[model samples]
Every structure is written in C-alpha cells, then in structure tokens.
Target: MKTSLQTTAFAFATSAVLAAPALADEWRLNNFLPETRPESAQIEKFAEDVNTALAEKDFSIEVYHGGSLGLPNTDLLRVVPTGAVEMSLMWANYLGRDAPALGSVFVQGAISTVDELTDVLPVAQEIYEEEYSEWDVTTVGFVAIPTLSVSVFCRDEPVNTLEDLRNVKLRVWAREQVETFERLGVAAQIIPQEETYVALRTGVVDCALYPALYAKTISLQEVTGYASFLYPMASAPYALGVSDALWESTDPEIRDAITQAADDLWDRTNQYDADIENEMAARESLAEEGIVWSEDFPESDRALFVEAVSETWKMLAEEAGGNALDYRERMLTALGR
Candidate 1:
C-alpha cells in the first residue's frame, strides 16, 4: 500500500511539471545610435520599464544597441519584414523604399511643431498601417526627439540668408530634400550621420542640413562655422516599430504587458525631453557649447526658403499617392490651420 501511494504522488508531480508553460521569450531591440546618445538613453529607459513590467508578468526583453544585430541603414525595411530583429528605432524617412507615403508626414513647412505632430498622428497611423503592412512592421509609438531646427552647418563660411544656401554642397537625407536643394542650385549629397563629420572635415561636402541636437550631442557646432536657421525641421521625429510577425506570435498576455509598458515609456521619456527644454538654464548650458539659437534673422529669408521647397512638397505629395494633401488637411483641421 505504501509503494502504491508513492507511485501515484510521483505521477501527479510529473503531470503538473509537463502542463506548466515555459518562461516567456526575451525580445531584441536594435537602434543605430551609440549607447551614449540621448535617443539611446530614452530607449534604455523604455527598455527598463518594459523589463520591469515584464518581470511582474513573467516575460522579459534584451536590448541590442548600436546596430549590433547587423542591420545596416540600407536594409532597414527588408530586415524588419524578415524578422531579423524584433524591434527598431529609426527615422521614418529610412523606410521610404517600402513606404514612401510616410514621408508625407514630414515635408518641409508641412509640420511646424511638436503640438502639430501629436495632433496629426491619428491620420498618420491610418496611413502607416496601410504602408507598413507591406513591410511587416507595426508602429508602436511616435516620439518627437525635441524640435529640430535645420541649417547649413559649415566650417568655412556663414550662410545668413536664403541666397547663401544656393550653390553650396550640402549633405542631406530624404529624396525631397535632395530634389529641393538641387532645384535651388545647391548640390545635395545623401550621407549617413556617422559619416557627416568626416565629410565636413574633408570638404567632400561643404555643409550639412541637420538639427541643433547634433551640435549638443556630437559637437558638430565645434566643427562648423555657420548654422543658417532655415525652415524649422520639427516634424522628422523618431518612431519605434515592432516586427509584426514577432508581435503576432507573442503570447497575448505578454503582448498586452509590453504594449502597456511602451505607453508608459512614451509618457516618461517625452516628458523628460520637454522638461529639459522648459528649464532655460538647461538649454543655455547646451547652447554654451556652440549652439546658436536665433529667430532674429531676416524674415524675408523664410519666404525665399519656403518658395524654393514648395514645389518639392507638391512633388512629394503627389508621389505619396495624395497623402501629402490629405495629411496637410488633417493637420490643419486639427490645429485650426
């Protein structure tokens, strides 16, 4: 009788062990920036929050920084679709191959400020789903990485007006920028940010069109002599996307926990970036390191700059399957534009 009772208890124990599920899978996140960059900092915070939430819910994640997963800029769209990586933080412009329609959201003079961006995302989301579905990625969150002011950063000469931008060799991204600048008689080169400084130093490119944050983070200010405040480039915000295959395959409870964690992260990280802007002293500290913030330039120049790029906007809108006008109308309706 004793032997029979022991055998029954062992059978029950083995059954329970077999029925219990395995630990949840850990996710991999990839970004192009160095681990020290502010964008990486924001991502790290998000990962931490998500990991914590996951721990409570019996799931986890592992972040891979600095493109360690071998996702070069060129293969971004293809890589995401093939599930080579689980998630990535990249500029939407990079996905132009798979989804040119996303560019409609960031055309010059199209989106002026962060408030306008937040209001326009609902419409953008609809468009992203249609476009990104082809690429097999889902837009999880759209966070503005502070408002970026575009300018010609040069080591040799100062570009103080719209005419000064003409005939200069500038490094730029996005097809529209290339087309627009070329039309204005400026020679445009499409180069990655990693190579921009060297390009400036070597004179391969005479100048670059990028953000002030580049000055703060990478010391581009020290490398350049002039920063022409042209159209405020606030709309080219960073977006975080997840591989649809991975997301769809994830356990439902784990997916819910991760989505909630992402929501929490967006609030925390964007608030931090915004709070830094609110504190004048903090912004000044960054400015002291060669950042020149001025709207004091001639208002006349703004019109010329806009006129030069206006046709490019129309071209992009037409290319994006009429999304350019649709997005503009949606934003104006939201902002009473």
Candidate 2:
C-alpha cells in the first residue's frame, strides 16, 4: 500500500511539471512619435496583432511611445544592435549623417504617390535590410506615413513660385531638405517640430515645409496663412528593426508571426493613407482654423523645383561616397526615375 501511494504521488508531480507553461520572452519596442499620431496608433495595433499571432508561443512585445524609454530618436542605429532595445521604429533620414545611403528613400522626387511607394517597397526593403544588417539589426517592416504632399506653409505671404521662396527662412529637417532648399535659394532653418509654431508666430521663420496633417495637429495653421503644394517628396520611410540577438534566439514560428503582423500593417498603410475620413478631417481642421490653401505650383515652377532637388541629390550622392552613389542609382532604377 505504501509503494502504491508513493507511485501515485510521483506521477501527479510529473503531470503538474509537464503542464506548466514556459517562461515568456518579453521585448520592448520604442517609437519616438507622439501617441496621438496615426503612426503611433499603428504601432500599438502591431503590438496587439503580434501578441495575438504569437499567443501559443512564449513571446510578447511592450510598446513605449514619445521617447519614454530614454532612447534618442537619432541613436536607434547604435542602440538597437546591442540588445539595449529589442525593437525600434527609426526614420531613414536620421541616419544620413553616418549612412547617407539609407536616406536615399527620401530623395525629394524619387517616389511621389502611394502607388509608386507601394510598387517600390519590396526593393526598398531589400536595400534597407542589407544596409541595416551592418549594425546587427534586421528589418521587420517599413511604413511611409502619408501626407497630401510635402508642402510649404507661409505665415503672411504665399509661396507660389521658386522666386517667392527666395531669401525666405523656411523650417526644414534632414540634410536633403537643407540642400534642396539651398539650391532653391531659400534660407533653411533647422527648427524642431515642437518649436515651429512659436517660430512661425514670432517671425523667427517665414514659412515651414512639412505635411499638412502634421501642421494641423500642432495647430500650426493658427499662425500660417497659405500652403503651396510642392512636388511629392518621397515620404521619409520608417523602418521597424529587431535586435539581431533577439531575432536569432526567437523561435522561427514566433518570428514568422511577428513578421506577418508587420507585413499586414504595411499592406494596410496604403488604405489608411487614402482614407477619405482622414482627408476630410484634415480639411475640416484647416478650414475651421481659417488657414488659406494655395493651388498647386505651376508646372514650370514645379519643374524647376524638381530640377534643383535633382542636383542636390547628385551632390549628396557624391558626398556620401561610392556605395552611397551606387545605392542612389539602384533606388532611381527601382523607382523608374
């Protein structure tokens, strides 16, 4: 009787051990964009989707927004590879100082529309993956936050021609924008986006070059009176990267689940960009705020702007070295420029 009782106890212990779940591998994802932005909302959805897809696996992701994680937006390239952060949504142009080749995606006239961007995305992903691998990071996905166009919003006067932009202090971001504006004979001021409203209101800068939706979000329309539709600057693409160590250690199934979630988000981004509701909301906001909108630039002016930006691209490619130039050429070819 004693032997039988001991055997039953041992079998129960074994069953309990076998039924226990494995420890979960938790990952942290960082996005520097404000939580209210559509991009940040999409990142949150991605985390939820990934969790759902990997429900059976011991994998999870926790998201941090608005720089809460203490990682500077510009340092993602350095930090992501060291496993200091498990994942990040990094802007391509932020790396221009060190790797100008990565900024080729934001070449002003390279890709103009969502359709064009969608067509070139596969090639872009391939190029980006190869470039980022040098930092021991793997590209899981890419997103191009939609804008009506890269526009020029002026405080008092309208910017309708290249001549109109002459000597005008316009807020700019990224090295490409500075060079492009320089060629166009505009004074480019590198102002933080958060500070742009006060800059415009106080006349620190005469105009700003940014997306219309963003301008509305920040109440920039309160100070700006007119907007000019410039040639479609390719949306500066954002990449979602995973640390190489985490990626390699993760189960293949978990990796696929995470990748699928990202790919689905990528596929849906185009629709989101084209959503009429979002477009109408932006229009309503601008109208309510009483910001005047200018018609598109004349073809002649548009052509000249494109020409000036094209020259800047050539100069940037040269300055960035042989590989950078080669990457630009490949992107141009892929983009059918």
Best by lDDT: 2
Output the number of the TM-score-best candidate.
Answer: 2
Poorest lDDT segment (10 consecutive residues) of candidate 2: 13-22
**Alpha carbon deviation, residue 45, candidate 2 (Å):** 0.8
lDDT of 1 by residue, 1-337 (tens): 3234334434443443224422446667777776767668778877777777677665666667766655665456655554455677767676665556666666666565667666665666566565666566776765545655665676687766556667577888667788777776777878877777788888898888876555545557667766655666555556677768777887787777667766766676553245335434433554676655444237786665577666776677677775556864554576565
Error of 1 at 250 (Å): 0.6
TM-score of each: 0.80, 0.84
C-alpha positional error of residue 252 in candidate 1 after TM-score superposition, expressed in Å: 1.6
Alpha-carbon lDDT, every model: 0.64, 0.74
**Residue 284, model 1: Cα distance from true site in angstroms:** 4.9
After superposition, the stretches of candidate 1 with alpha carbons farther than 4 Å from their true spots are 1-24, 56-58, 269-297, 320-337
lDDT score for residue 4 of model 2: 43
